[model samples]
Target: MSKTLHHGLLLLRVLSEQPQGLTVSELADAISVHRTVAHRLVRTLEAHELCRRDHQRRIVLGTGLVSLAEPVQQDLRTLARPILDELAESTRATAHLLVRDGAARMRALMVVEPRGALVHVSFRPGQTHSIEQGSGGVAVLAHGPHREGERPEVSEARAKGYAVTTGEVIPAVTGISAAVPARDRTATASIGISVFEYTDLGQLGTTVAAAARSLGRLLD
Candidate 1:
């Protein structure tokens, strides 16, 4: 890849971690580029409306990315809809599709609640949290090679083909997830369900893992 393009992408990645925005000097330091080069890159991004200067002169991701991302998100939702709906109905819980953001965060891309279910967990899409915080995150982390000092949940997920946790994302709730394999290395995602209670963890795990494998085949 061209050095300029590489640095530009790195700049955007760095800016994504700081929702409040970052100064050009801080951006340069974050991306290991010179201040002048960072300025030129930021200006180029600003021209494309990919990044913009805030009132405080800090650079933040611009609205342009939303327009670019919407269609992709929609397509993913469309492809996963039937599977997620089946998972939700079979598991009798709220099923969700989550995608990795940067290196340490997971965002819910879509959510499906079981039809005719009374008193099921319900959460909106776009919920973002630490990659280590919940079953969905750990399930996604289980993809790729194992890392030293990784969480036990991740290791367990890798071995068992699914992950389970209780009260991690929300109090009194249980989550089960399995990683959805993708052809693109950069595209990390998971399929999961959240419930208030469940007696058969093994069955739930098997169901979710099967759903994940089905989705993974489609994604690949």
Candidate 2:
């Protein structure tokens, strides 16, 4: 396969395992390449915020994916901005909007940061995640979000209505995500929230579920 495709798939596989985002070195070994090569591959993914570097020099999931998924969400933000904003204001935490590009790629976002910690923002619009790397990505995958006409794990999630991704994508980051069925069969979309992995644990689950419901209403 071409290097671009190779790295892209590798990045995806890495995130699929869990939210414990991979390090350049770890990712390098997974694909049987040199660390330097893996580092470069990660950088490519980073351009889309599919991965991010952490204090330990490890790669973590990013919030840059929201913007890339604008179309998939069908302008969920545009239509639901008021509700989303109110939720953000009430939660005082970051809120995310995400969608999958059906085997093409996945995108996410951390649209509004809590007013108190806007400076401590975690994700920006247009951030993309390697479907292979984080709970954010895996949440979509676990829910059987399609890619290239394949629904990976949506059935399981459909039976469950929500997917909880932890330590699979980002080591210190966890994400909770839920999908909103779409009219288009070719692709599917979901909305989720991500935060540092070290918080009260359950908080990640609770907040994400609430945010997802808030967004789900927009689509309905």
Candidate 3:
């Protein structure tokens, strides 16, 4: 379409990645456009209600995007709930769906809660992280063989059905194995379960595999 429209959309994509909002400079740096061009683009987005500028002059996603995103997120959550619950029961531990951030993956949603008081792990709504060498991260990155950059081992993970992060991302946790049913289009998500290693690998593996398969069906 028009130059303004194209630049506005690109600016919106950059803003979408960050919840806090971005300065005009940050946006310019991220998309590698000139500062003036980025400012004009942001102003256009604001006019359309797709972006908003704070008092500090930072840009954030606006009402117009919520209008578009609400429907899609609603459907995804509805479809994923039952599968996440089933995975919780099967694994006898926490099961989660994680999305990538920058170069890492952080916990996004969970269907289970850790039981013990002293040895407890919980995820909050605003959790943010990287997509390093972890099971959940690797699975989402590798499952679709989405080797667009920086990860040659992602191929190994795809061929192996699931990825195992043996305390690479976390400490003392034996491992997490996860599967990404759909990474080609929906790149920021996967189905994964954590294990303490003292638990039964055979039964847990089967359970998680089934859960991943079920999730895969939905993604397909």
Q: Best candidate, TM-score-wise? A: 1
lDDT of each: 0.90, 0.59, 0.66
For candidate 3, write residues 51-71 as lDDT tens digits: 898778788888887577667
Root-mean-square deviation of Cα positions for candidate 3 versus the true structure, in angstroms? 4.8
TM-score of 2: 0.49
Per-residue lDDT for 1-220 in model 2, tens only? Answer: 6986777676666665545567777787888888887777788878878768878777766656545544755666676566556655655555666666435456664366666754333666777766655545555565554446533444444455555555664565556566544444222455555555334545545555565656555566
Evaluated at residue 216, the lDDT of candidate 1 is 80
TM-score of each: 0.86, 0.49, 0.67
Query: Residue by residue across 57-173, what tens digits does model 1's lDDT show?
Result: 999998888788889878888889999999999988999999886567899999999999988998899899988889989998887679899999899988998999889998999
Question: What ranking emerges by lDDT with the best candidate at the front?
Answer: 1, 3, 2
Residue 141, model 3, lDDT = 73
TM-score of decoy 3: 0.67
